[model samples]
Target: MGFILLINFTQQGDSDDPQSAAVEQFVIGENKVILTMNIDQQVTIERAGQGWRLLPAQRLSNQLIEQMMRTWQQVQGQVLDIEIDRSQQSGLFISMVLADQPNIQLFTLYLLAEQVVVHNHQLDRYFSLPLPMFNQLIPTGLLINQS
Candidate 1:
């Protein structure tokens, strides 16, 4: 059976600018959230009071993390046809957990030859992200030690 999911987002401030609209969709308050990604391997980052810390003693450079968060906050993408096949190998899987929320939002992304396909389980919809933005956000070495 096929299921349909609808995305509910509110336009904050300027609706004409896609960046501002994208930023409004995800609001990470006080850094009270955990971001995890699994591509070739799994790496997780959690709020460390004022900053972010990687798991298992890996130190992610503050600058790199900040840049990634900025990209995520301003990411712009378009929804593709919902009938696309999802049986291909998933290239990336990301999940976010809010400190005050009980549910974990998950996104599965497939890196195709021409486009990046993202499946947002929370919204039950698929989106095609810009290649540049996808490259910025999905670097395999971003979770490594920077020191």
Candidate 2:
């Protein structure tokens, strides 16, 4: 069997222009709602102390999730799937796949606080997850499925 590489829209090299090439296409394991580009560039989105941050592709920390869940008053049922939507100008977009039964809809935005604000879009109100915590929440099952 043959495999393909995926490129995210947000990642830019030395050039000013954004990387437009789709090296390969893949969806996060299991949940079909989250789509990932460029497996090499897969960064987990999570929440940090009083802010958001990004975690490199690797093992997810459950402790972070526990902290975020307590701070943000979020539960597993509230989050469907978290994905890196590199198409936006804010560095990244944490697409919140709502737990809509039967059909999952990508609604709301878990965006970086620097380039965006909570009220800028409707998604802001729901999941204002910090990048670090978001990244820690990366589902291992999903990562394995991508393989």
TM-score for each predicted model, relative to the true structure: 0.62, 0.26
Best by lDDT: 1
Off by over 4 Å in 1: 1-41, 143-147
Per-residue lDDT of 69-106 in model 2, one digit per residue for the tens? 34322322122223444455333233432223343223
Total backbone collisions for each predicted model:
0, 22
TM-score of model 2 (CA atoms): 0.26
| lDDT (C-alpha, whole model) for all candidates | 0.58, 0.34
Q: Judged by TM-score, which candidate is best?
A: 1
